[model samples]
Target: MAEGFLRPSNGRMEDEGNKYFNDLLANSFFQYVKRNECEIVTSCKMHDLALQVSKSEALNLEEGSAVDGASHIRHLNLVSRGDDEAALTAVDAKKLRTVFSMVDVLNGPWKFKSLRTLKLRRSDITELPDSICKLRHLRYLDVSDTAIRALPESITKLYHLETLRFTDCKSLEKLPQKVRNLVSLRHLHFDDPKLVPAEVRLLTRLQTLLIFAVGPDHMVEELGCLKELRGALKICKLEQVRDREEAEKAELSGKTMNRLFASLAHKQGTVLSMIFWRVVCAIRQKW
Candidate 1:
């Protein structure tokens, strides 16, 4: 996704770029590929041979030690046990393009001005700096399995952001309120069922949302806006649905999905039947 950032962004490069990534993996360039329940590659470990081939360009900074080419480093891997940022003051941040941190705690000012991809999965970080809005060139961000509670509102201003992930963030309950501002988002991989923000339906280009929790504020009908949704989708709070009319507005008949799960009302009623009908229609069109 980071390499897909091109001039005159028409948004087709990401799909093309993903193909290259898949091919490289098939050719044994990468290993330990991690995927979510919906089969999205959340992370990967570069093969040792491949790492040696790109060693000059990438730097695996352990504990921010003074490396030989710290000034020219573009890709950095924080392999320290977690905390301590004392030795990193000399490393320039303007030229950094990617950062993968295994640190348990991330400190210091968020100053990666030119960073493109950031992966902090399983980190102990609790919050993001408001200064993260400075990453204008960022295209991919993953904070899966972290302890962060919320994303700073400044994140919504990243119009060029293509992929934003918070999968398995048990403490992070919801996405930023103005998520509609991410006009270029393609995939939103998360674990929370109720992470839907206001005007999420506006993201018609979105292709991945494995869990859809229907809250009173955001009804089931909003699913109609995501015509491209595929794979598995679990709908919680189906009882809040008003009636068959509201459920019908979801337009799930044409959606090609492998699985669609919903919690219908416990008691038999019109709402229960309505929920059941929608689920059946969705299943019939499974991909």
Candidate 2:
């Protein structure tokens, strides 16, 4: 278990001084415990447990000493109040297996050769680097409650990914067409009220889908193609169904997708802002 607080030395700064920093430290300690044999975990011992702070202050003063080689560390989490440029620069993501949470990903060439999973919850992140497509081993990603607008076509390269949650990505318009290539995906959550994209039916392995809509009818034809979704599909609008036969067929067979709510309408711009926010809130509560 992570300690509630880390007491600082020199009677200097209290953990209360920076809540985000303290939280990161506590989480890092727990991570170290999970991966005890890793060398970087050993180095976390140098700083006084109570007085210990972030590694950015401890090992970043020198250049060649760290940020490279056998002493190199991975699985980092620096979700402070602002952009964590220090953490971004210090660790090599290509060798990383996990990252707790980060804000912006709009810096330098993000070349994560072997990265498997990344989480950026409750951060200020607005856009993803097109370079994100380079991670051949990536399997999981979460970018909830951020300002991101859309995913790049390059995202199709993550063929191995299984879960992707873009909940509360309010500004997102549509998913990239290449999304269909993620044949391995099992769960997906995107809060866009736009028509469910036609590309989704291609992900034959998908089981759980949380979707918002511009009008469910917009992609009704494509929805019929998803024969593999055996779990549930929580959609924003049920009124989009123009074909009663399709709905009835699936329901009668007892194999139809589960609907969270039965109806929705298509109206964009600020005039529909109230409805949009209401549906978004409902999705969050359900999730």
TM-score, cand. 1 vs. native: 0.81
Cα lDDT listed for each candidate: 0.74, 0.56
Q: Which stretches of model 2 miss by more than 4 angstroms?
A: 1-72, 88-92, 212-221, 230-232, 249-253, 256-259, 264-287
The root-mean-square deviation over C-alpha atoms between each candidate and the true structure, in angstroms, is 3.5, 13.1
Query: Alpha carbon lDDT of residue 253, candidate 2?
Result: 31
Cα deviation of 201 in candidate 2 (Å)?
1.5
For candidate 2, the per-residue lDDT at 78 reads 56
- Backbone clashes, candidate 2: 3
Candidate 1 residue pairs in clash (backbone atoms < 3 Å):
none
lDDT of 2 by residue, 35-76 (tens): 222111222332355335544322322222333342265556
- Residue pairs with backbone overlap in model 2: 193-213, 193-214, 194-214
Error of 1 at 112 (Å): 1.1
Tens-digit lDDT track of model 1 for 157-188: 88888888898888887778899899888788
